[model samples]
Target: MGGRGAEICCASIPRVWYPGMMVLVRWDMPDGLKHIVKEKMVEVEKYDETGSIYIHFFPNDEVRVVVSIYPGYSTAHPIRHYGKPENINP
Candidate 1:
């Protein structure tokens, strides 16, 4: 695409992927998101059909993240402090 931001398409997104499917637990994007999130388990706390999406981002993926997201959003939301290194912490 000319004059457009680079898009990193997931050539191999998990087979569980769908148009509006919710992740029940943490999921790792080692290949698709290696740059930003190395090989970490990105937690997707909860999800709704047309409402808020609860996401938890912790250093260990088992704790609660400090930041909170607004409910009932209809757009992509960015999460801070996400990702990790393959051999070390990010």
Candidate 2:
């Protein structure tokens, strides 16, 4: 792995479902941006047997969700805002 990157490996992800599911994505950037995003799940129209889910990171500590309904294909979905560490209230 080289250059700036962000990753949420399988070790960091859990198999069980929890309320308010959130994951900390490891982001390695020169500017040192925070990486955390809420877990989202949605259904998409499956045109074929191949499909995938994607998580997109942003500079402002935000994330966008995308899904592929079929292989070798891509589509755009509405962006969603997740809570940061500071966004939480006591």
For all candidates, the clash counts are 0, 0
Error of 2 at 29 (Å): 0.5
Please, what are the lDDT tens digits per residue for candidate 2 over residues 1-47? 11233443444323333445544334444444664434434322222
After the best TM-score superposition of candidate 1, give how far the Cα of residue 22 lies from its true spot, in angstroms.
13
> Among all windows of ten consecutive residues in candidate 2, which has the lowest summed lDDT?
81-90
Error of 1 at 23 (Å): 8.2
Candidate that scores best on lDDT: 2
* TM-score per candidate, chains pooled: 0.23, 0.32
In candidate 1, position 39 carries an lDDT of 37
Clashing pairs in 1: none
CA-lDDT, candidates in order: 0.31, 0.35
